[model samples]
Target: MGKSLYSQIGSLQNDLNATVGSTENTQPSSKVNRVTRDAEVTKQQILDAAVIEFAKNGLFGARTDAIAKSAGVAPRMIYYYFQSKEGLYQAVLEQPASEFQQMLEQMNLEELPAIEALQVFLRTVIAYEISHRYQGMLLFQEANQNQGKYFQQTNWSQPLTYVTKILEKGMQEGTFCKQDPYMTTLTIAGICVFYANAYENLKHLTPDVELLSDEMIERYTQAAINLVLNGVLA
Candidate 1:
């Protein structure tokens, strides 16, 4: 029999820590760096596979075996990394928010005018939804089937707060109509994700459309931004 999954993961973690500890003490060797990189790659591979599985099947329908097979790892590896399927599902749900936070952090949103800021936010979110098409589908599935139990556990406050501040700034600056920031945020997010959520049906309905193509995505993004900004602009 091969090595147990628990032992395999523990060993990899130990090796990773040892490599990092050595690097802290002295200049890192090429071999140590390579090992560290490989470990990180392996972990990411597992996450990539889990994302696809969970997105396609949702939590209740997803299987650890399928994820492991897709990742080219042993079945127990999933448990070793995530503890359980539910844990992996939670990670999938949290990924978009984490990525969204990182993307927003890189932008100089505070300095932009409120109207421009809102437009930027809308474009960014719509682009993200298009690029990560599975994420929107997964979110829709969770909302309808699981009633957003896993989604609630994720920390979305950062992006939500960011959008709320933009709306408030717009209202204060007299660039946008006064509205409930939270509700407005919901509406904006709905607009950004609606196409992605309905992609399958839309594709079936319009076989020639290629809705996810770059040109179409650009058209959709621009149209959404225009529609939203027009509705709220003072």
Candidate 2:
């Protein structure tokens, strides 16, 4: 028979405790690395659970106890790593922004044609918004209720600047008509967010449709990319 859930959890706890109790000075380097890795894994678990809680309830409404319960960690662990609920919320926002920056760096947009770069950027945003639906909703809530205070606290400028550079490149190449880069970036971002923000309403209006199915996502993504590109293309 498969292990019971409680038994599995108990086994994991035992393993974690053993790793933590291992003496750093006496243990081999491999054991020390295991301890560090285990700690990171535990911290990540708490963050993942906190994301769901914050997305559903917003920062003001979410509770640390609930996050701990959801993460399957002791409540003290949250305080130990994140310091406070607000700290964890900040980390959540920062993590995605950091990932976005890394992705832009890896894309090497300078090598691609202006139009191709724009398409790749749009597709990436749309796919990320679709996969991380709750993140979009949480951002929306933060903007409305918190006056975007948390957003201002993170390093979001790099990604915004990256998009603006793409737009500027297109204009310089004479492939896209001259326009305000900031406004153009906003327009493209809005276009990508539209379907995701309106998903529930769309589902209500068309009760038979699976709006999130792969086919529908592809259709919407392609349509949005084509529309944005056509508007900007000279």
What TM-scores do the predictions have? 0.83, 0.85
lDDT of each: 0.77, 0.79
Clash pairs, model 2 backbone:
none
Q: TM-score winner among the candidates?
A: 2
- Candidate 1, overall lDDT? 0.77
Model 2 — TM-score against the truth? Answer: 0.85
In the range 1-234, model 2's lDDT, one tens digit per residue, is 012322333443344334344345655876877878789879888988988888888889989999999999999999999999999999987766776676667668779999989887777767666666677777876787688899899987788788899999999999999999999888887898888877867899878889887677778888998899888999
Q: Candidate 2: where are CA atoms >4 Å away?
A: 1-27
The worst-scoring run of ten residues by lDDT in candidate 1 lies at 1-10
User: Lowest-lDDT window of 10 residues in candidate 2?
Assistant: 1-10
Candidate 1: where are CA atoms >4 Å away? 1-29
